[model samples]
Target chain A: MTYLNKIKIFVLVFMFILFTSSINAQWNIPADAKNKKPPIDPTHTLVKTGKDLYKSNCASCHGTPGQGNNIAAIGATDLGTADYQHSHSSGQTFFQVEQGNGGMPSFREKFSSDEKWCLIFYIKSFDKDFEISGEELKEQKADLRLSLVEKIRTVKAYATTKDKSGKEIPLEGAEVQFFIKRMFGNMQIGELVPTDNKGMASIKIPENIPGDEEGKLNLLVKFKDTDTYGKVIKSKTIKWGSKLKIVNITDKREMWGSLHRVPLWVLFSYFGMTIGVWLVIGYVVFQIIRLKKL
Target chain B: MSEVNKEGTKKTIGTIVSDLTRPIKNHKGFTIWILFLLTVMGVGMMAYVDQLANGLGVTAMRDYISWGLYISSFIFFIATALVGMLISAVLGLIGIKWITPIARIAEMIALGFAMWAGLIIIFDMGRPDRALNLFIHGRLQSPILWDVTVVTTYIAISVLLYLLPLIPDMPFLKKAMTDQAKWKQKIYKILSFGFEGRPEQYKSIKKLIRILAILIIPVALAIHTVTSWLFAMTPRIGWDSTIFGPYYVTGAFVAGGAAVMIAMFVLSRNYNLKDYITDFHFDKMGKLLVLLMLVYFYFNINEYIVPGYKMKAGDDHHILGLFTGHYAKMFWTVQLGGMIIPIILLLFRRMRKPLPSLFIGIAVIIGAFFKRYIITIPTLVHPHLPIQNVPEEFHSYWPNAWEWAITMMAIAGAVLIITILAKLFPIMPIWEVAHEEGITNEEMNKYVKES
Candidate 1:
């Protein structure tokens, strides 16, 4: 009885302390941290690393352009809007990113200070005033293809971005998504992948998927939205995999067999009653014919 | 009433024979009646041909309401066909002697409807040509196989029951009618089988009749029980009940009994056989109808109350539809006029008399036909999944003009068959009547009188 009373009193005191502390604690950053300037340049290589990290770690909650989708619903600010981008100094935004508020988690341990500054520069690019040249847009074309590996009996799709002059440029930061077109709709194959420095991205087509009756499959590779390059999709059909088989009849040993489904007594009784009644009817007809002789 | 002799005793065998054969001998309006029936049947056949040419798409039936008027009419005919079993076998076995005069009328009605019952189903099918598949590839487990088997057996037994008593009457008709065609005489002579009133022959005939009578009861029960199984075997809301067999049997008796009464009224009025089909027969039929309706009422309560009480998920919609929804009016009318009012009216002596009984009989017949309609159509519309993605018309059913024409023609066809049979044979069993009156063959010829 004493132990129960002690627990009840302890819980009440702890709840009271927690309630008062939360009410007083404001998510205000220090003035020195808010005024701090980034030491590194917003170079292309840094932005590329930031884009890959954003897709993997942050795009799910912040959305592709950080427009605040369902994830991190409470405090995921729309990073694209000019009001947020222009109002906050990069230092203030960096402090907020490092120290998350409410439903947002702190990314202090996950990313380096240099990587956080790269993310800030990339987020500011979503604003319309952050002008991108037409030459840069023309160079964002991705070359996507599918190839079958005969030794492994597996199919792989590769995506590589090319420059405007048809030069093979490394599309290091683009996200490649794979899909297979089915009769009803397209089915996603695997998780999205980021290309390496060599501008190469590939995924293994699963072995178990049943293709068309002729054992042909249509594989689709997509270069989804990226900071530098936009979106690109390509499809290829290959003769691979086993065809689907449909079996209508089963052996008598199986549960679905006719022998098991229909009971024998039902058969015997149905036939027995039918024949017995017909025999009686036949006798009556014989009686009519016999009446002809009377 | 039959004419009285000089001594005020009942007329002898000769007068009985002449009076009984008078309807067949008469020519008044017979052609017109046949022509009317044929015309209706012709119009129906033309519509059937149109249905055949255009496909079942012409009818109002669709994916949801697959069955319509033809199936209901088929059920009505099967139910009406039970009169032969009720009057001839059920009552006859119980020694109801008054039924002897009316038994043949019931048998004719049974034969007419039973024959068409088999044909009426063909009208509902999209491919009537595939009918042979039923016999060739019929599955034994299906209730349809049970129905076809029992309907054929019932038709055969009903024919034998109708023909056996006609045997003794044929020879009497042969001797009495000199004006009938020689071919008709030859046919009668063959049909009579030279039955010279031998004691051994009478004994054999009696034994055969008793054997058939005993045999018919089970077949009769099987026919309607199996018919009811067609609905009860399904998992539909209102039809899926254990009592459907008895419920259908009792309802059949009500419809069939009323049918016999109607035929009794019409034949007695038109053929002038007032003495033969007397007030006593109508009174007996009326009392039997009352008993039947009361038994059916008990089944009706059991059939409805238990389901209505629980108000199970699917059944609630169906019960509400019949009780107070769109179908409430027709449903209540059929219940009140068909079963309830008839039961109430027949309880009084005056209502059981010939004229009033005739009106009651008509009401019961109409109500019985609609009763089958109620049983079939509502359950179909109330299928488990909500009705969707079909035409607006598919949600409810009404028999269109084409459907009505075909259904009415089927009824007319049954009447046409009965008319032809009545024209050929003595409507009542002459030999049975004479035998019951204790008249002999020698007395029949000697006391013969010209009508």
Candidate 2:
């Protein structure tokens, strides 16, 4: 080949290497051992049962083999991988399956108890086991089962007003405030909760409200009357407990008027002055021009 | 001077008023009807003022039909003003002495209506207060700026053309006055600029008029060309065309000729000017109108036919709309009544007579207004994208009462300006008339006898 032909070949090869190297760099994965996981075989019966249960219910989102590769699982974790399973507990998975996570519909009423267990088993099969102590298992079981102390940290309120059908109306825009028991305990922990547009308010107990051993918190929740000045129309109290959850506090008196106002005099005066000044200036100019012409 | 001979000399205001009222007293029916029409038009103007105060929403024009009757009237005014340049400037340069008698009238009409066009454009703007922005932020690239520049130039030149020859006539007017008010005397003195009709002043005035007459022709063409570019520059399907500039100039001449004919008919009959503006002038104007109409028709064919034949995808909706769709009636009426009918009417010798030609002129003027409306509105209705997310009212345009009232006010305002100008200055060019009679005694006597 001629020297010119060799130069042309070298340039073509250089361009091909540059393009392929850029494409490879974009698709490169980290070589960390922690990030890598052995794939699970679907032929295992336990895995197969989990896959069947998931397909019948969760596969629409979690995908076959719990890969979380389904269309609905976009922006969600890939469940078939071991890395994701290690971070979550069996109890947390069961709760998520029963209550549903963001964008995932709840299977609480849809699946039987055995089917949920099978789904959980399939999810677990993706991870290699780590040690679990007796104390940790007891703590996990205790947290899974909702007790009175565990339930105390949550509260739910509903709107009492309704149409002619007498069904509870969704109350939105109601303000809910919580106050501590001690004297001069006026410091507010959180901002006021304006009820949702549907007129429902939910308040969760703060975790720092010292455990039961630290002198019981005398908690008081009052529905603030928006129309009246400094008025507390409705009040509720929860005695010494780890936390308190009040559900459905629906009273007609709990509904309050809005706290929005616009002063009329200020609006009118501002506009009036602007228009008056313009008219006077215009008139004066016209007179001056007329006089000059005359 | 020369015993102020009433028959062959200037008449006093009292004598002129007596002479003018004598015909009115004898013809009460015609006088009363004219008075009644003037009253109605005045009332319409009062209603229009109410519209200006309230806003354009008083009219049927929604956003879709933004430039409605107001825009049409503006186009009509600009088109009419073209006649002044065509007659005074173009014919004067060519040395057509026959057009001299009516040159002042054409110039006055052009001056009055061109000024009115500027006012009407401001009135059409949603934010009339922002009209000064057209100058302040004016982009040379914009056709609107070009329009503003050319129109301002045209108006200035037209006013100068209308005023220049009046220098010699001003002394005649000043001396002829019997009960002239103080302000009127002052105005006449100032306007006359101490014109003594000296040889130098006369020569200077003639030179000035000649310069202006030469300058006004291209400015006249530019004004209409820029006005057409306001639409043609847009991306709208019907409006984007290379032929629009010359097409618009031809239409301007057609409309301008019609306007001149109408003005001549009205002023001659009302002012008893039959001797000055005779059947011969009408015959000449009729022939000019025919020529202009033919030229305009040829441009119209180029404007509408080729794109219409190709039926380009973008233009299909707009073309179909004009051809046999929603705008068919207006398109046919304007094309036929404005161009074809006037051409045919003016073609016949008998129809070129004053009465028939006057009717044709009126038809042409009204048709031209609708032609402008068709030009502006249909293209807006069919923009590049499909109309969406807007109220149903935005899809179509019809001028509301306010638009109609304001449009009428603009027309009345133009007429009012012409009337006021005619009152101040002689509608006929007095100096030109006297010059045509001759500068020497024996020649003047022969001219008197010949007439």
Candidate 3:
């Protein structure tokens, strides 16, 4: 009995140890990724843009950064705390944001490197000792237009501004994003591209995308740095890509189908068997009626 | 039909008709028994009224335990009603001579319970008015639709099977029962179907009953199998099973068999049917019960052991609750008292006697009922999604006062139907008994009572 009790205690303690160790195990970062640095200059406009992105994407689960109000249960760090900010190098924060861990979502596909760095800069601003260190980006309004390269199937976006001579000039060094309109939201179609000296940024729309039954796609292009250029969008509907076979499941016979769409076999068997048996029953009733008349 | 004139020795046909038809007359005990059943039904009616007035909130059912006592009772009724097909069709077709005295008894139970099974499903509905939606909007793809089809078919066939056998027997009631009420004689006349013992009518009637007998087997299996599908269709912890169709069919036999045994015992002891439903009959039924239970117990093992061995996720809690957790007591009681012990005891010759078999029958039947409750209610509580954040009532279920009353009403209602049927007609078939005793149909048609 004593030996049995000892084994029971060992198992209980073992389980307890296993449970506690899984809570917030250290998140490892690649050595090369640890030394990385921001490639973009942080500015007040960049910080505002970062704040808007944070509200839309991260604040729901992670909560607001500096308020120390992130849902701690899901293991979101309190960015306002000195221990958190001081311990995390800029590169470490960058790697963490790009790769993510556990409940955190990786932003590698969702954002450009510059957008991630700017978002990181705004989060680091929660620390009282941190200071801004770059010239602020000035806000401006710009014109945006779209064109499709039919031969190459590439979609191009142009950003421009009027010069003092009232000529259309190139808006250089601004980022543009291309998208395809979908049911839930605009699906990102290509990488973020900076406007060249010609004021043009373009992306090759993949050939494999299945469009509407008529093979039409509603293509959209927008300025990435929304705070600087405002919400300028350009779009066009084009006949492109393969057709999708749209099947309304309710129109087909299925196990979970509607009343009218029962399978041919099920209807045939159900009615056929029922009527056959009822035919015998009908014969019996006829015999009874014959007996009645006699 | 016979005279006890100079000597007391007479053929048994005189006594058979008189003894069988004698129970149809006014008896004080039967009257009081019916009144008692009516009183129970009255209470159930009031409770049902409260349920209708207040929706289903008057019952203890919630989102989790959506099916309470009414559904289980519906299952129980369907289970009991299967006895008719088993005794009359399955055993009878194989030329089992002993079932003759008990076949109509089985049919009466079948018809009574089946009629109530349909009503009980409507009782489960909060809006009994929308019960027609089951047909109006019903799809052929669903198991519920299959259940409706087969059950209605079974009821139709059961009616034909029950009433058609009475055609040749009505001459005795019509001619010998001249002193009966004018309405009853008229009913017997209508039931006669002018069956004047013609050879063609005899040949056709036999062929017709044989046809229905053959038809009812698959329909019976379908009713129970489709009923099982209503549960097995879902991927719940306990109910999702491939073997559930055969398992339920076997278990139905056990419940239905026990029910027949109990009915046989009561009728023999109380209704002066001791000569026909004898101890020998009880012994044969007891042996049949053992066979039915062993098969059911085999399925029970398959149901629990494989799942219990794995103990995966929700099933672990469900199995443990029955094995050693909250449900352990009721679980063990049902297993030991209802099935295992009865199976063991009835194996003995003495235990197969009428009195002992009745006790075992009661235990098996009561156990069968709660087994359905255990099967349905416990599995619902241990659903796939974790139950969190609700009132304590939603945590588990026990049928409230209203649920119990309404359930009792269904049982009483079934009993009331069986009783009214018994009062109107003979519990044992007159034609079947006469045929079994070597009396010709022509002789039965010519039978006249000695005043």
Candidate 4:
């Protein structure tokens, strides 16, 4: 038993080593140079170009100063913040712009090299202090005023169970759940709130949330066990204007009953039995005829 | 009288020619009708050309059921072909006398179906023109390559097995032809290979067959095992199981047995081979089917119940689908109607009668075809990633008209080959049967002396 156990352990270790080595061999990046970079001048021509590009292209969605807004650009990122810019590299941004990052479309075919440089320049302009000085401050302010919307303060929820006759039905103590997904990270944040007597609940956004400058947030409201429990009742993303409401979460659930609900094993068994029976039947018939003829 | 005896000796060729042609003269009408039906099936195959020109989109197969009937039918052909190896080599090695008569027929069926299997695979390919890439740039590590290798080897062995025995018969056929058509004479002359029925030629034939029989066992196992590996190697929940190799082989034998039975029934009824193929043969085959069915059932239980017990998140969809989900109807019908019912029916003594067994055999073949479909499609539908972005029609697959027509054409083609062969050659081994029944000259002399 001891020897058998040793052999089993040996095999396990061997397999682990084999797998790790194969993975290591496949990754071609050098380890040491992952974190070296040159300092940036916030007011360079590159920076002005970047700013101009941002106003024309990105401001409509990401908003002025990268404070994300614009209904169509609800999922766009904020580039105004210093910490976020310093944490990511120009190469990373270039790659994302070139190849497309998630929902973003590729700009390689649409933009020229100088245009890409201009976009990068505009992105850097989000920084407050810079060495290069030729840009007019008035134009920048005008762009900002035209694009910027008030930041989201808080989200409030209201619910009621009544027909269009305006008669109110009690909906207190019903569990309400809120879900938020970040646009860039696609991370999900959720909280469950019990409805008050008026069938209303509000959630306050915590100050100093990580990556708040990016401002890409999608919110959803769902009720627990209201015949549409475990289903998304109401959902909306907040990007530009602050006020967002989730209504009729229950109606949507009835309209779309769980589209993604198939279990994996059921499909497997389906194939299994189908193939299994066909083979079994064919065998029996062939045998009988074969025997009779013999 | 001596002069008359000389004339008789000289007229031996003429007499044999008349005897051989007699059957064709009598059955020409039936032969013409069967050929006409076969030609219609050939016309159906032209529709498949339209599919090839259009694309697989021509088929009803949606993304969900991407591998519909063609794949299943391919599996059926592969499984049924297993008998060629099993009976011809496996039983032959074991010195089973009763199997010898049918061994050649089994081999021929194997070869015919194996060839059709290749053809159907080409038909199934999204890029049929790229099929040569399978060979030119074939990767040995891939199970598909292994399948290709083994199937080709099996075909070669099957042809050798069929042809070697025909050598002796070929010379006899050559001399027996009185008014042979040009093509027939040419074919006979080429195939005869100047065989004179000498002892040396007999010894060489026997020796080669023995060698081939020994070699064919591993090749046969490799063919089905490699086929199973095609699925098993995939990461799909149903196909990734290790039990697939033996599971596939068992299924292959089961299907192969059914194919052989079906062939026997058709040939016996058509050729009036009552003397050679009898009820006793059916009884024996019924017993074999029972054994195969039981073994398959054991594997089936293991395949389903073990996974069903675990019901892991990955396996959840597939298992539920078979149990009470969308595919539940097909699952239950194939398992119960195709396998369990046939097994139970064959278990009783009365049901083992030739006619009843024939009915059961046909059921097994039909059921096995659907079983192959179940094996392929559902697993594909339930991939690791969620289904998205594809068109709604991509979610399910049913055979389109072109696919159906083409697939039917393949089946028709196999039957056509069998039909043509039966017309030309004796379905039963005349020499072997003569020897077995003690009707040979030596056997007659022994009987006379004893009397």
Which candidate number would show the highest TM-score if scored against the true structure?
Answer: 3
2 or 3, greater by lDDT? 3
Provide the TM-score for each candidate, comma-separated: 0.72, 0.59, 0.77, 0.58
Candidate 1 residue runs with Cα over 4 Å from true position: A1-28, A35-56, A63-94, A107-266, A292-294, B1-12, B57-63, B136-139, B193-197, B312-314, B381-383, B386-392, B439-451
* Model 1 agreement with the true structure over B1-451: per-residue lDDT tens digits: 2221112346558767887899988979999999999999999999999999998888888888887888888989999999898888877888878887899999999999999999998999889999999877776667887899899989999998988888778767877777987877887787776566655666667777777888889898999999999999988899999999999989998888999999999998899988777787788889999999999999999998899999999999999999999889999999999999999999999999999999999999999999999999999998888888877888888988889989988999999999998988889988777765677755654443323
Please identify which of the two predictions, 1 or 4, would achieve the higher TM-score against the true structure.
Answer: 1
CA-only RMSD, every prediction: 9.1, 19.3, 9.1, 25.9
The 0-to-1 C-alpha lDDT of every candidate, in the order given, reads: 0.81, 0.67, 0.86, 0.66
**DockQ score for candidate 1:** 0.19
Give the per-residue lDDT of model 4 (tens digit) for A1-294.
699999999888766655554454332323332332324434455665566566666676567654545433223456667874775455555555666543355789877766775676666555555344565432110000011123555565665554456565645665666656556533334466766786666666554444334454566666644332234356665553233344544434231222222233433443453345335334433332232222
Q: How well is candidate 3 docked (DockQ)?
A: 0.45
Q: Model 4, stretches more than 4 Å misplaced?
A: A1-294, B1-29, B36-40, B62-64, B175-182, B439-451
Q: For model 4, how does the per-residue alpha-carbon lDDT over B252-291 read when each residue is reduced to its tens digit?
A: 8888888777777776666555434567677777888878
Steric clash count of candidate 3: 0
| Per-residue error (Å), model 1, residue B6 | 19
RMSD of 3: 9.1
Sorted by TM-score (best first), the order is 3, 1, 2, 4
Candidate 2 at A116: error in angstroms? 30
lDDT of residue B151 for candidate 3: 89
Off by over 4 Å in 2: A1-67, A71-294, B1-53, B179-185, B440-451
- Top candidate by DockQ: 3
